[model samples]
Target chain A: MSVKQQELEKSWQQYKTQQRKKNLYYAFLTVLSVVVFLAIWEAVVRFQLVNVRHLPAPTVIFQTFIEKLHSTVPDGNTLGQNVIASLQVSLTGFFFAVLIGVPLGLLMGWFEPFDSFVRPLFELLRPVPPIAWIPVVVVFLGIGLKAKATIIFLTVFVSCVINSYAGIKLTSRTHINLMKTFGAGTWETFFKVGVPSAMPMVFTGLRVSIGSAWSTLVAAEMLAAKAGLGYMLQVGRGVGDARIVVLAMVTIAALGATLSALLNTLEAHTLKWKEMR
Target chain B: MENIAEKNIDTRPIKVEVKNLTKSFGDLLVLDNLNFNIRQNEFVCVVGPTGCGKTTFLNCLTRILEPTSGDLLINGESADPKKHNLSFVFQEPSIFPWATVEKNIACGLEVKRVPKDEIERRVDRILDLMGLRDVRKAYPKDLSVSTAQRVIIGRSFAMQPDLLLMDEPYGQMDIKMRYYLEDEVIRLWKELGSTVVFITHNIEEAVYLAERVLILSNKPAGIKEEVIIDLPHPRDITDPKFIEYRNYITDQIKWW
Candidate 1:
């Protein structure tokens, strides 16, 4: 290569290396903070700074985590069984919420007649918390997966509809006009122009909803479940074992985080056409 | 240049007939009884004062706005997208941010339900013409303003619309880019032979690109004068005759 061309290539390589180093530094900071926090927690418990009865040492929590995998001593079911049960209900509820809520929200945003019919009842439900349905849920679905899933679905469904509605409502007027100039019909424009424009916000809603699915799943199980992380937490409390409670809380957090990370990957892939700026 | 006077006698069929068109926003009358006729394959540029209802007139012609009174007929029938293929490239930004350059260019054809093969064929031709082949898969956010405008123009011409309305499509560009894009437009108009109504406040842009220049008066606007630009293709802006027409139109806009 010519000297100038080689210099330009070398500079570009340097810039890329700088960016890589910056990303590595940030990742290191994240791991360091977590390690420091865990070390502090272990030290506090070992020195009896906090009561071992309340805040168990990290090693004690790890030991309980290992035992819960095989034994069902304190709680009625093992950790593996509880996790599977929770996944079944939450995923079923979340899947249906996405299928129904996204289209309903898009339709409501574009069609005035449909919005007029569905919005008032939706508004009424929006103000009521999803937990409020538990009493009615117990009465009808009778403390089964249906009841827990229903609770998770209601909590997630509202945000999905709200975000999707607002996303479509904010579809640019210029885009609609451009489509009109092309001879597009109303429904055609909605699918072509409106839906794609709404996606970034639609994804924002989905991330928020998935988080809701997990939090609401936990709350529902705490009250009425026989075999989930939240149920184990409740039973641990009833029998006074802090290790089991900590294990369940940690598992709930880890699973919630993993699901959200998976969704982040999906968002990046689907919105590849999106403006990074 | 004088041959254009002889060329004036040539009869081309009328493509756009604006009949006593007027538009009002409640008490505000923006377009007042404007009337004009544009021949088939004509490149007409309209120069008007800022906010002198240039956009309003174009919107009314496209029926994007309900004209307060009178009719806009294309090929002697009411202007309708279904009846006559129509396209607009306004001052607003181009391309759906979520769509690639190729997809954005193909959108008008897709809306017209053009067959898959034909859409690809036409889009390929436009990508070459508009110099967008390199960035066909790139999103608008990755492009410069000039390239994005070309993508918009490419999309408009891909449909081969019977009438194309462009309202300052290159308004945001710098002078060199604007001139370059204007020449590109002139070349495209010749190759495609679609009737174009190009609205701009830039008088020299009108001189550069138009076969006919229609100057509009200030708000409560009407067509004030019609000047035929008899200059030849690749006309130099520094040419004396070019300056004369530009100055004359500038004077009319200033006076009116």
Candidate 2:
């Protein structure tokens, strides 16, 4: 029986290896397809199928990205500086939203009084887009870092609050009962069982909120701003610098994808125990 | 019926007493004016039809559910779980999935704040007893159903409670594993001299493990009969007395 068990384990390992290889093959094809699409865009631009003034080739955008890296503007800022600026503002807003949203969501999920009283207010405010709040924010705070941060914060806050509450609500009923049987008091059960169980869902909310907060950067930057990737894109559009605009768009996509991947890793690490289940 | 038995048993040193224990949820009554007496170190098996309040009796004993109107006494006083060493092994596997077999077995000790060295000693002994030494570090999800059930049993037995409550704990196991675990429970109970309240729908199981068997009626459950088994430890399943009692209880349960 032991020998048979070893053989079965070996065969399972081999099966997993084959599955991984197949997945990698598919992933390679996906990358190849993306490359092919980019090549077509380059071919169209090189052959002057579309005016260079309107749409730059991949090579033009790549050069623009490199040039912006080396060239500092009047305020001692380069393209990298602009990217960092946008990230700082956006992340600041996102963090504030997380700080406020998580507790509010927990209260809404765990307590009937808060759910009844505060949830309605949140629902009423949630439907209004974050960008729509920009006019009022600008009127109060003006076009500065604070105004941009406020917009991003509001954008992420609604989604985070909704997701966090959902996460808490989705906690397993069995877990709570088990704790109760163990003689755990109400507060102890909430901390030991409810919070840990809801963590995965809360992380999901954070992921969605982070994505939305990043998305609002470009919109926030479209308004009056001195230095940010969004401001750079705005400047490029003003001067008809299609190469710079393309570079900004590519940077935004890359940043969004990278941040999302990082959050996925964090979620996986925090939920390692769930993997066994 | 249990109430009749309750009246017959002298109450001088009763460990637990149930008086007019009636329970109802909404319009449905599950337990009706039930009464029973459990002495210290006695092993009692409650056999009943589905939804016949066997589980409800155990719940009331543990104070998990409030009795609609009843008095539950432990040691001639009101039963308070916090003050008593009482533990329950649920019908399904209730081993904490978050903890390994060893850690799960040690949970009550940890909750009760037993010394570290003592916990380690007792955990090792229980793991050995359950034949789970090899899977000490294995989580519940990684173990087979039989192995997981052992973890639950081992955990409760580790607590060495004054009264151990088991609710159809071996219902999910195969025959061999079930008998083995039942014997293991008997061994532990004998060693600790703890009172036990075991609930099962299986008539054979009640006869095999219980000192006294209490049969309950179907929905709107009332105790139907009680029988005392005088057989010695490691009872012969085919013994004439065993077969006689088994048949009599089977008839009572089936007809009622």
Candidate 3:
């Protein structure tokens, strides 16, 4: 090999080793911090610094968490069943919202007349929080899966529309003109140029919506759920079982993080053209 | 004097004709009654002071911005983007960031609904011509500024456009890269035999690449001068005749 090629190979090896070391360090820190936090919590409760009823010891919560995996909690359903119920409602609502919202937003952004008609209604509806819709949703659809999924759908749909609209609005004018020069018609330009350009923003919307969807699902479940993490929390609160409440909260957090991470992986795969963050 | 520049050129039929074209934005006039004819297969460069409506002129030609009063004809008919196979490279890098280099170059042909094999053939030829074959699978964000601009240019050429409009495509490049790309453009023009209307603010660039240079005055801009560059290809900057042509155009642009 030439001298320059050998030098490039050496640098590439050095870069790879450095990256690996950095990743290992980050992983170590993450685990150490979690361990320290759990230890501090366990120590404080064991020493009776705080009431164990209000704040259960980490070991107690972990024990309950394990026990609830198969055994019924106060709601008469296992932790696994609650989790599956929540996932089903949230994912179903989120899927439909994305399927409809992204295309509607793109069309509103691309055509002025469509924007004129929809933007006023959208603005009127945007500020009213999705949680505020719970009473109305209950009245219209009653206390069922439809009611809960509708709540999650409202939260996810707003974000999807806003981001997708902004994406299409901010599309570079030069790109549109370039499409025109290539003899592309309105629909062709929108589908080929506008849609693809809006993808990064659309994925960003999906991430934000999924996060909101999880939280909204919890709220909806707590209000009128028959089975889910939020229902478990509600039952725990009614019976004054702080361990179950804490367990439910932790489960909700972990599930939210996992789902968001999955969406992030999808975003990275689709938008590999973006500069790596 | 205008007739002098018109003499001794190949009698190729006129490809673009702009007659008394005037454009105004509200009360602000931009292009003031301009007329010009570009022959088929000619490489014409347009240069003017900054903000002299060079872009507006090209926009009018491409029907992106309609002229208030006048006509732009392509082969004796009004210019219609739908009917014409034209391409434009903007002042900024306009390659689709979502597409790979190869796909970006093929975008025009795809839009025109060319056959798959023909599209591949054209894309391969342009990739080879632009020296982008090695980086065909790379995205725009991964390439250097020069390579990105070359990809845009390659995209325009891949369409095999009847007339290609370029608006200072190398305006952001440093001098070395600009000159290199200018040579590449000239080589491509020779090879493809497509008419080009290259707009730039750089006089030396105009002299370097143009068969005839159209110099415009300040806004409301009009053609102030047209200089025919008779210099041979592979021109040298230090050549006395080349310097003379550059200085002659420079003197005409002294409207400050």
Name the top TM-score candidate.
Answer: 3
- Candidate 2 residue-wise lDDT, B80-192, digit = tens: 66666678888755666656788888877776668999999999988888899999987676788888888888888888876788999988788999889889889988876
The parts of candidate 1 lying over 4 Å away from their true place are: A1-18, B1-7
Question: How far does residue B142 in candidate 2 sit from its true spot (Å)?
Answer: 3.0
Q: List model 1's recovered fraction of native interface contacts, to 2 decimals.
A: 0.69
Q: For every candidate structure, what is the RMSD over all alpha carbons to the true structure, in angstroms?
A: 2.1, 3.9, 1.7
C-alpha RMSD over true interface residues, model 1: 1.1
State the TM-score for model 2: 0.86
Stretches of candidate 2 off by over 4 Å are A1-52, A72-76, B1-13, B115-118, B191-193, B236-240
Model 3 lDDT tens row, A1-277 = 6999999999999999999999999999999998999999999999999999999988999999999999895889999999999998899889999998998899999999999999999999999999999999899999888888998989999999999999998888999999888889999999888998899899999999998999888788966678999899999999999999999998999899999999999888988887775
Worst 10 residues of 2 chain B by lDDT: B1-10
- The lDDT values for all models are 0.90, 0.83, 0.92
Cα displacement (Å) at residue A18, model 2 = 5.8
Higher-DockQ candidate of 2 and 3: 3
Instruction: Please name the candidate that would achieve the greatest DockQ relative to the true structure.
Output: 3
For candidate 2, give the lDDT.
0.83
Candidate 3 per-residue lDDT, tens place, B1-256, comes to 3555667666899999989999999999999999999999999999999999999999988888889999988888998888888999999779899999999999989889999999999999999999999999999889998899999999999988889999999888999999899999999999999999999999999999998999999999999978899888989989998998899999999777
Q: Give each candidate's interface RMSD in Å.
A: 1.1, 2.5, 0.9
**Two-chain DockQ for each candidate model:** 0.73, 0.31, 0.82
